[model samples]
Target: MHVPDGFLDAPTSVATGVVAAAGVGIALRRARAELDDRTAPMAGLVAAFVFAGQMINFPVGAGTSGHLLGGALAAVLVGPWTGALCISVVLLVQSLFMADGGLTALGTNITLMGLVGVVVGYAVFRLVLVVLPRKLGSVPVAAALGALVSVPAAATVFTLLFAIGGTADVSVGKVLAAMVGWHVVIGIGEAVVTGLVVSAVIASRPDLVHGARGLARRTALRTGEVAA
Candidate 1:
């Protein structure tokens, strides 16, 4: 969610800002190992796609709107560190150019949507893959489930942050209920899009997808097929 200014107090915003900066710093170092000639271009394309996907917001009742968080999608396509960085870049551009998220609240958006989203989404994805059938087919299913859970997780975290530093005095339970409820619906959409995209990429260019790399190698070894 793109939090606007005045939603959180100065101290909370600044704390999130520090957290965001640290997250980005760590991601920048880790992403280098994840990106290469084959995956670097795909990472750029994924960022652009996420930027576009977030532009279309769906009404989620009570005048609140939700859009694709893109953390799961990005982490599936790229690695988690790069996915976090990709979303951070998208947030920066949106905040600076489109004004989608407020300037002062940029760090909050980054922490909520970029750091928390990517970390939770990727963790759940890996966890799901452990229990599901370990096939190329299972990758998308895990990715979808990860995306489905991550949205509400982010929402829940935001509600907590709001409870701590919300500008207005609102009922924490009501806010949590509404945020989680609407976000659960939004998560379904996230799951659908993530599954479709991950499946499509696996079909076409599995070599380029970070989450599918192991499966791609196994298929290549089994079938003696090489990716073009």
Candidate 2:
């Protein structure tokens, strides 16, 4: 959901930049507590993976394309604070080097794809896991659903922003319908990939997955039972 320059009015864009800067600054400080030796390397890898993942864009109905935002994936692999930072970093690189997103609109992209995406996705994932049975497999399922929902939620947020500050004269209702409809399909792909990756990580190194901590505890208990 990269909003190109001129899509939003100048005042709106500048306002979003201010908000984005504040959010990123908070995230950087929060990341200091979340980052560690193990996660530091993994954070870079996650950023690279997100960067690569975004390259393979699926066509939307309006001739536009969308790709993995990777918020939920990053949050699951690392931690939420680091996940936000990683996505922001990837967005910044895409803006500067790839010219994929406009430099001036960088803050808008970060707010939608990085901050809002991660916050909503991670919160949903945690809530789902808490409601579901605390089995080892639940973690991946939760992550999958989180990834799925995050896309549309971000789209909805964009629609709201556009309604507030969009240059185009499109009806807010139509924009919301189009954005949410296309993102539903995107969310399906997100669910599949996120579930697979999270499950694989839990199988091999559950310790590495932030969302799999409960799963690890349950597995350890089962192993202890069998040993007994």
Candidate 3:
């Protein structure tokens, strides 16, 4: 969800701005390590894909809408640092030109969707991959689960920030409930889309999928043993 202006106090907005700036700075340096000639072009593609996906929002409760955050999808297709940068670029463009998100709340949107979303989503993806079968197919499963968790996680963080510096007199409990509740439904769509995309990439070129870098598909050998 793209937070609008005046939803939070100036101090809260400024604080999130600092946090977003720091995240972007770190991402800029670290993303270089994750990119190379073979993989660098994918970053631009991922950013564009996320931008388009986010434009199609589904109605949520309270007259708000939710769409694909693309954090997990990006982190799976590219690296996390690069993924964050991708999301930040999309948010910047949307805020300035599209008027899809608030200019003043850009930092908050970046912090929520770029930093928190990618960090948590990628972490969960890695964790899921560790537990699931070590195969290319598992990458999509991991991505789906990661996408599922990332949405509500971001929503919860936003609720906390709103609780501290909300300009409106809305109840924290109501906001939290609505945010988490509706986002849970949104997360399912995120999971499905993420899984489908990851699966497609894995099918054609698993090497291109960042999360499938070390993963390999297993086949049954003549002896009925699985081999990678």
**What's the TM-score of every candidate structure?**
0.94, 0.91, 0.92
List, residue by residue over 38-153, the lDDT tens digit for candidate 2. Answer: 66887899889999988988775567677889999999889898999999999999999988888888989999989888998899999999999978788899999999999999
Regarding lDDT, does 2 or 3 come out ahead?
3
State candidate 2's TM-score. Answer: 0.91
Candidate 1 structure quality by residue, lDDT tens digits, 1-228: 899999999999998999999999999999999999878999999999999999888776677777898999999899999999999999999999998898989999999999989999999999999998868999999999999999999999999899999999889999999889989999988898899999998887777778877778866555445543
Q: List the residue pairs that clash in candidate 2.
A: none
Off by over 4 Å in 1: 59-65, 218-228
Candidate 1, lDDT over the whole model: 0.91
Q: Go through the candidates in order and give each one's C-alpha lDDT.
A: 0.91, 0.87, 0.90
Model 1: ten consecutive residues of lowest lDDT: 219-228
- Cα RMSD for predicted model 3: 4.8
Model 3 over residues 1-228: C-alpha lDDT tens digits? Answer: 899899999999999999999999999999998899868998899999999998788775678677899999999899999999999999999999998778889999999999999999999999999999977778999999999999999999999999999999999999999889999989998998899988987776666788886554232122124222
